[model samples]
Target: MKQHHVWTWPIAGYLFLGGLGAGMSIVCAVADLFFGKGELLGLAPLGALLCLCLGSGLLIFELGRPLQFWRVFSTQRAVLTFGAWMVILLVVFDALYFSFFSGWFPWSAAAGARAVVAVIALLLGLGVLLYTGIELSSMKARVLWNTPALPVLFALSGILTGVAGDYLVCGLWPYGGPAADAEALAGILRPLMAGLAVATVVSLLLYVLMMYTSSNPTGRTAATRWLRGSYALPFWLGAVAAGLVLPLLLLILGGMAAALGALLFIVGGVFLRFLTVYSDDRRELAGERERLLKLPHGDEPFLKSNWG
Candidate 1:
């Protein structure tokens, strides 16, 4: 079957920004309790809000019409319904929690209320993070997205990005005050970055391997696209090399390198989502492609729409 209405750049932008927001929400919560008092506690929630708004806005933009956007909420499709609701809940929870941190609410001084809001926001944040992957993987039309590893891979990537974001905010913004506070935060973040980087690389490899070996020919095609097709350059250079490798190397050097590493990691994160959207848009059933290859007619159509 011919492909139409393919996912494009908007989808990629949504996935990247939404994943960053979700990851940041959780990181903010952890920083709130762990550090007790720091710039991150305030920055994380604010950053999350900005990311979520921009990400969600892109989703609406992808719908291509204002009137049709509301249908996303009423849709019977599990992916749409679940993702929309999760984003909604995340926004509500994070908004209230951040309001408390911002001291806009008089009851913000109450530890019990803060604790409850923070916990709920963190859970919703996680839901938002995982939903992005689940939504993509649920697309039966794309063999590459059907794997169970996609959700896990996205989650690990989100965690890595979230930590990187925190490191950047704390290092550059320095709300905690004094060089010593930054040093203390760095001590905590350095090893954490190392661990997350390792996990992200492993998950990425597993995702590629699983998709490559999938029984479906379409699945294999999807894998090939990522591995060696038109997407090869962006996948290798943008996502793998710049996104993963360089960040890990810089992070190992410690100090300001962490900020540089985080920035590079964020770039990688964006490119990774771009790879996902563009790669799947090119996916075609492998069996169908083989049949089309045997056509007695001109090879122009076959070559023009080559599955690979």
Candidate 2:
């Protein structure tokens, strides 16, 4: 079988940004409706809109033919084409809802209408988040992406990064509220940061563990790449240390320290996306290598290449 390295940094950016946006939208909606954090409401929509636009733009540029991007909308094949449409639709809903609430749209007073748009956009955002994982998993050729845990891992990470992003933004711009309000918001976010960070860490462990235990040689090779291979240092330092552990510890300190944790979480999220894209064992499988070695140097062990 021929291996294809179709996804690159652009796709990785799309995945990370889309999840970030979706997570922020959901967090914003929940906060506004449940917690009455009026000061934090605007951040969610604005963040969602910004993320959707930027992420989708990267995806379009990645396509290499922007004119043909519309083809994704007209087609339906697993989550590939469907995901493209999801991004577009979420952007529209987020934009409309944002404009309405921000006074850019005249009919902003209609609470019912605003609520409807917000709900649709939030659902679409979540769909886009899950789609990132589903799309990757659909690529049967990538051994590391085949597990069910991948989507869960991504969804958890998305929510984790989303909450962290919200914490950072709210800390910086308290939406005209006093310093105490920012402190109050931080108080709310402290526990959340710890919980989400823990979830992301646990989900990641299960993902790697699944790959490690797979009976397939390709799966085993992919796991080994992270454990003690070329990708080991970055995986541990960037994804686990910076992204998961540091953020959790910082949040426990609270106050200004949580803001730093949020920053690290964002960086960690980006690194995770980059590593996942680059670490795939798209090279020839171990079984294929063994077969080729047997065919080319049969009965002559000294002549066989030590490529393994």
Candidate 3:
């Protein structure tokens, strides 16, 4: 019956950054393979590599003993261990992919090797994305996070945010690409981002609906909190309106509106991760509340008397 915090901003930051990094890697790989936009000069891949590295750092920092992070590789059965390896491999491959684009070494000129590296990095990136959601959903005690919808929702949001990030980097950074190339990339990415935004909206709605109607009372309570309780303002305004709807409208408007929308999308993605982390309410067992209430308060006279 003892109250304990589920998770905090550090965990949320790891989740958000992990997903965003994975998403950027995916976009980078796809662009090279399909659109022939290798002219991006490896900025996207480098950004993704940094994001994953930073996210991994946050996870390690959250551990009780941060110095023993290498112990994560000591076991293969644990989900966290698997995730750790996934991140390591993704980072390695992503770095290689970036080196190819950046021409960091003489071997970087090999197109076949670069393509292979990109594909591997892309797959590993996806695994990292799924792992972020699965890490939470596997905890059955938190009914709000136990559903399959969570991974799907997380994946969609990750990709959306990743595209937004790519757009922003290409727009703001001088080294991103030539002006004409950036414009062309934006033209291609605009419609893709809008579609992803729509899909994310649908996925989010479905997730909330599933939680609200779940047989588990805890799940319903969590959903209710987001719908009409203390979390409603952020859920409705931050996540839904500014994060999703407004972004969709801006994408439609194009030009400066599109850039602003991308920024909002990134903000909204962060908001979603934080809100989800904070909203994890555990399921209550029968008679647990009553038993806790019957226990003496910390400030009770008997406890204060120091009769020991």
For every candidate in turn, the CA RMSD to the true structure comes to 5.0, 6.0, 3.1
- When 2 and 3 are scored with TM-score, the better candidate is 3
Per-residue lDDT tens digits for candidate 1, residues 1-308, read: 33444788888999988888898888878777666643544667778788888888888888869568777788586876888888877888878776776655788667778778888878888888999999888877676776688888888888788888877776344253576766787678778877988888888877877877877666677778788987788888888888888889998788677689888888888988888777674355457667755655666687779863
Per-structure clash totals for the candidates: 0, 0, 0
- Kindly list the per-residue Cα lDDT of model 2 for residues 125-209, writing each as its tens digit: 7888899888887777777886678888889888888888778777343265577876787688779878888988988877887
Model 3, range 1-308, lDDT digits (tens) per residue?
A: 35656678888999999999999898878888777775563687788889889988888888889998899999678778888899889988888887887666899789999888888987998898899889888988888888788888999999999888887776443244558877888898889999999999999988998899988888898999999998899999999999999999999899989999998998889989988998778889898889888876766676668863
Predicted model with the maximum TM-score: 3
Q: In candidate 3, list every pair of residues with a backbone clash.
A: none
TM-scores, all candidates, are 0.85, 0.86, 0.91
Q: Please tell me which model should have the higher TM-score, number 1 or number 2.
A: 2
Q: What's the residue-level lDDT of 296 in candidate 3?
A: 69
Give each model's whole-structure lDDT: 0.78, 0.78, 0.85
TM-score head-to-head 1 vs 3, winner: 3
Report how far off residue 12 is in candidate 2 (Å): 0.8
Which window of ten consecutive residues has the lowest lDDT sum in model 3? 169-178
**lDDT score of model 2?**
0.78
